[model samples]
Target: MRQYKKVLLGVASIVLIIVLAACGNIDDSSSSTSSSGKKTTSVQTTGQVSKSEYAGVIKNGHYLTSKARGLTANRNSNSLNITSFENGLLGVSKSYYSTSNYIFQEGQYLTTAKLTNWLGRKSKSNPTGLNPKDNGKKNSSRNPIYVESIEEQDFMQKNGNSLVLKGITIGIAMNTIDYYQKIKYGATYQQTITSKERVAYGKKVAKLIVERMRKIKKIGKNVPITIAMYKQAANDSLVGGSFYAKTQTTSSNISNWEKMNVENKVFPEISSTSDYASNDNKSFENFQSQIENYFPTISDVTAQAKYVNKKITGEQVTITTQFYSETEIISFTNFIAQVAPKFLPSGVPVNITVNSANGIQAFLSRSSTQRNFKSHVFSSY
Candidate 1:
């Protein structure tokens, strides 16, 4: 009887160990759930939250937009203490510019409704056939789409190692123009003008504003000016659309006449004649060719690269690649950093971000003083 009890106990101990091991395996496979019932994966080492968590924080467009505007308006300091999610997602703080006082004065002449109407007049198929009007309209008490504000901010370059403080951003708010209707219908204004015509018009508007701004004696004569137009659509609070133009004063003539000149004589060097300011389209084409010749694996995939003077970061190279697995993100990002600069204008510092179908997979940035790129991996899948 004693021998039989000992054998039975041993068998029970073995079965208990097997059951515990199976439970451990199940726990390993399971993910933690948030209060909203969303599964979350924690990176214990980096303490980085999942992309969904980051998106949840950023999706509050009103709050984010207000925060960005407030940060730009406050002239008391240079640095801002952003939350962990923002830091992790954006990777850097103080990347945007605060517009100078002179630009704000010029903004008074341009209202959102007026600009829209101006574009409407320029449109080839203006159903109403509105006449082209000069930008002398009184500042409307309420504007549907207007230049709400301006700011001067910094831009990161060279994988985030260099910083450029020559960015001027014009904030635009679209309050009307079927603001709510477009959301439900999924259609915005149909383009009546050719892409070339639209670009020409935008450039003309920018040149006029730049001319007025140069009249301000406080601004330097040789300042390399980077003008960015950030537009917030009525339906969306975030800056969904942006346009850019770059120019510099090569002439010593700082007279009122020189400042008033709207012709090409005012700006000796115009970086781009397009709407977005930078020479991104040509650079993108060149980058595509380089990729095809060098990296065959991703050569056939459709890729797009643009130099964006972001609100938070002065200037950045945002690249969207064809659907790529998370594991390949690092390799691809390194490859881009190596080849992209070759096609872009030299000496302009800019950071790089790699995006896939899933979302932003990696961010490579450097401060102006740093030489090496500090990379942040967000999502692999």
Candidate 2:
């Protein structure tokens, strides 16, 4: 972990001056730029998803937005799952829609309202409902809204200036717990969903979804499709859950579902669990302890690390603070900037968010290519 923390002092000043260095939901840019100052995500050529242009540049400086936007907020009751469901879908899509072959684009086939109806419970009013009907039954086993939300990602290949849709990826956000109210506006009771049942239901929904996309959406039969299942984390859970399994289709029909041993666990979680990456947890604990020791005013420090095949891949840490002064924020950020790479696991991108009760104070990220962190201090005004 410590070996990857070698500090590069050459570009420290230049990095700190940049406003926003990467693309994300919370950030300004939709394109990702590397340390070399060139946009690492772009599709300058036509035909096949270009590796250099994975994000797929639509215009000179603009990026294309999916037909469906902002509907994600209504997808899950838990905010954490919403973020996980969206980001994790793309993460899983990279495997099937390789950037080397296809450029990235938002799902264009599904509409916000259509998705809303699909996620809705099966009923006379909404025939597209993917969730099982409640049938006024008080029992969860008999009926529950097991399917939470749906997401789509389109993979494109360039032909001259125009782009060709080569594939469509769908993400099924499934619930681990079925929260039901026996009566309207009554007490809510949760029915725990087992892993076996969760995966089985997810596959059924995926196949059915593809069938509809072809019949109704007019999707070309030759366009490849990928389907991934993401397990939604409990609303109260600190970290959002991750995609567990994915299946790819050559034509229109999905086949040979492959199991993905992916998971997301918050730091300071149960260390006794078999999945616990012992060394990684220890490093996070040390990082938390150090922050606590240095800044007593900081409220808390927590990390959500993603594991693939039992190995740590990426981590996002949040530090809640009581400080407001820019000097104090920079000072604390500098301290974190110095100790983070030294104490935390490396070779994976790590993003740290410093937050105040009001909102986000600053954001710092270390990409896999860089030895140091690129940061932005939000304006206090």
Candidate 3:
């Protein structure tokens, strides 16, 4: 492992205690079935709390395109906490909040649900090619996958024994594309990855994840981050590895490798000036351009850990500090609320509120990319 420089990107808004005065009451009554078998509810009470108190963690969370690829996380943390499974079978929807009593899980989080709806619903010009006709009735059954594992990594720069710094890494492994293909195409499917398609989808997922998480922290700032996709070895030159260079050595090595391959990879495909001038240089440049044309760029965080010591030893223990800005927390929360509704108790109502200052501006900001993403609960009004 190599050391990377740590930078302070930006400070989150200070918590200013403001008075939010609101109150609600609830009453409940229970009844049992007299005739056959099923017991039903008589009366139920639901309450609302201040936004400041809206907090909880939903575990075993999953999204269904076919089966589930568990993408679980602490709703309050930026590090996407995930579990590892061999076939990418993990949870999709589990609800957790710090302030459980205050935050009502009965109704859906308005902004979160919309974002999720956008994720599953197909669009007329979806870059991923997933559409309504594509995800149809052949694959009818659906269930939220349960999570099995969880791991955290320390990614922090320490100064002294006083513990002046801290950071964390959370990862979730999933088989999302499996479900996507099964439901959309009526059979389990795997992504066909050409180098171009891989690069394009990789970039696409990276961009989306960044944009998705950026709501918490403006991306490319001080947040030292990395993401990678995990799949069986394809070409086998390298297994699913770090997306970008983590250490100086790795970065340099990757640069050298690219330089070595450039001549054979870039210029040999070009045509001569005579052919260019005579035949108009008909090339596959456009076909070869695998830009952000895929969905959910499969990725894992490439967290860099730093140290204050110049020496190394087996006894040496490194500590890192990681915290989520309120924005990032809300962004992740909204993401779960939007995408994980299918796993909630059956008949659970979901309402998404966005397009306002306090609503879900994070995802909706990408309006051009999310045209079909509409509000079914809140916007219904």
Model number with the top TM-score: 2
Tell me how far candidate 2 lies from the true structure as C-alpha RMSD in angstroms.
11.2
State TM-scores per candidate.
0.31, 0.78, 0.24
TM-score of 1: 0.31
C-alpha positional error of residue 131 in candidate 2 after TM-score superposition, expressed in Å: 1.5
Off by over 4 Å in 2: 1-53, 56-64, 70-76, 270-275, 374-381
Candidate 1: which stretches are off by over 4 Å?
Answer: 1-281, 292-315, 322-327, 366-381
Number of clashes recorded per candidate: 30, 8, 45
After aligning candidate 2 to the native by TM-score, how far in Å is the CA of 229 from where it should be?
Answer: 0.9
Report the C-alpha displacement of residue 325, candidate 1, in angstroms.
Answer: 5.5
Alpha-carbon RMSD, each predicted model: 22.1, 11.2, 27.0
Residues 69-91 of candidate 2: C-alpha lDDT, one tens digit per residue: 43432222677777777777877
lDDT of 3 at 230: 30
Can you give the lDDT of residue 356 in candidate 1? 54
Error of 1 at 100 (Å): 17
Pick by lDDT: which candidate is best? 2
